[model samples]
Target: MTTSSSSPTVDHAPRDPADGRWTPRLVLILIALAWPTQLLAAGGILGANAIAGVAQAFHTTQVVWFGLTLTLVSTLLTPFVIKLGDLYGKRRVMLAMTALGALGELLAALAGSFWLVLAGRAIAGFYGPFGALSFAAVRDVFPARLVKQASGVMGSSVGLVAIVSPFLAGWLIDTWGYRGVLWFLAAATAVAFALIALLVPETPRHAFGSRLDWPGGLVLGGGLTAVVYALGQGQS
Candidate 1:
């Protein structure tokens, strides 16, 4: 008997099939993540719709800077934002980004100077990573089998917002001007923050003990900024 001893086997199968199935909680998480993603995607159209008003308010013809600043800042910030989420926590970074985005929107809404408005747009660019982070968060939280479906849901939000945001932005700009558009963004971001706080759970998987490659990030950001700037200048 002593010579025939063996280690006991362990069962690796899922305890319950329902554990990974679609549920109300997962649905809520999807909604919470999708809300901010749609808002982030809507920024470009909103800015375009309100450009004339913004240029007149600022008394400048260089209305391109409004969109340009946002695009550049977002391009620069997205990599860092994604890394931070991986190192620390997705939910934590998302809440901070949403809050900052709302603050940026408010600043733009209340700003009286052209420079201040640009600054606000730069800050709001933090929202750029919302879609990427939301997708990652969905992957982290949803069961493997359901990831594709969840991703589809998240991807659809952008298209849906695109269809509606132009009409909404036109209405807001017509009724209340560019500042009103900023105010609407601030309000929407606030709602997103609340929903995320209430419904979205923190992801368990994190690249803990891993460090962000700051030097690489800086190099990449600089290169991207240069390329984007050149493209914009070429277009102009």
Candidate 2:
């Protein structure tokens, strides 16, 4: 994950923030290198795999509906991820997103119910912050000067992959089946979580991070779950 220090030009040696220098070009490149992998872990592959089970559980007719439902719920949860970052720390938020995404993918792989699947999908969606946070992580890791360039590079890498993620995810599902795809995604997410643990460091910004807002998280998560479930169910 990232901290407020969103650039790649980080001082390996402890230096004052004022002394820390980052290059926009270098930070952008790191983000670019990391983008496709993040997309595969967070969106492109896992998302497409999720559709098969949702289709099987809810019917093909409701696949679109399920997607819509999940999207809305994700919208609800996404801000909380950011806000929690504001309150706590960005790295903590990102770790939650990664870990939760991994858990959700595994659960969905074994899901038995429409409700259960919805929950799993929601958990998976919680990890969606890779969309925004990689930049934040770059910001966290690098100096302020280079953060933008790094963002561009990382953004470019993933942007190119965006065109193909769906097709690739689709092929995996078609070739192997839903469970297989989920299992693979689960493994991928787990790896991602491990990488975050190993490669990424917690931000000093959140060293004295804000308290977790359990009530807010629950209330928001619950409301979103209800809305997504209803939409997936396609009520009149």
Candidate 3:
């Protein structure tokens, strides 16, 4: 009798040696991811708390634009940034965005006019989707058994930041004024950049074959901006 021969199967997925245990590297990676997630959550709180100081400094009632610009830009860019992370490597894209965010924070801190501060906030919005990126990175790099735990830690970080940021913002606003708040954010984002750069690994899988739908993104962003702008105006 003749026997048929079959080719051996190969598993190509990325592997970690410490798949089943909590390793130091894993903890560092979690911290790297969670810190930026915290910063992103904290930004809204800090902005809201510091609005009066911003108005006083610039002597303009249009301080509303500080929050509005950030919200609008974040709404517009989050999808594009996420798609870019999928197409390119998540770590690389995340670093670039975080660096841009730090620069924006610095700009806002030093800006002499309200318009420049709004422009800075618009730039800083590039960092808005960082938490989503961190979650995707966890999926990409963590072992199957560790993903649930890692995700739980990431989700909990937001709650932690929410509880702490209001108090932190209030103190900063009291001590150094609104610019101090921006300075603090810039420093925190820079630390996040360093952590991610040093510890987080790039995702092995990428959707290089996929194409970005720019037209759809533009239409959606424009519609959302219009609606949000109208609502914001209505509130005033």
Best by lDDT: 3
Candidate 2 lands at a TM-score of: 0.67
Sort order, lDDT high to low: 3, 1, 2
lDDT of 1 at 145: 82
In candidate 2 the C-alpha lDDT for residue 205 amounts to: 46
Q: In terms of lDDT, which candidate is stronger, 1 or 3? A: 3
Q: Which runs of model 3 end up more than 4 angstroms from their true locations?
A: 1-14
Q: Which lDDT tens digits does candidate 1 get at residues 38-154?
A: 787787788888889999888997778888887888788778888887777788899999998899889989998999998998898787678778888877777788889989988
Best by TM-score: 3
Alpha-carbon runs more than 4 Å astray in model 1: 1-17
Of the two candidates 1 and 2, the one with more favorable lDDT, higher being better, is 1
Q: Could you tell me every candidate's TM-score relative to the true structure?
A: 0.89, 0.67, 0.90
- Backbone collision count in every prediction? 0, 17, 0
Clashing pairs in 1: none
lDDT of 3: 0.85
Residue-level lDDT of model 3, residues 61-86, one tens digit each, is: 78788988887887777777778787
- Whole-model lDDT values for every prediction: 0.82, 0.61, 0.85
**RMSD, one per candidate, in order:** 5.7, 6.9, 4.6
lDDT of 2 at 144: 70
Give me the displacement of residue 184 in model 3, in angstroms: 0.3
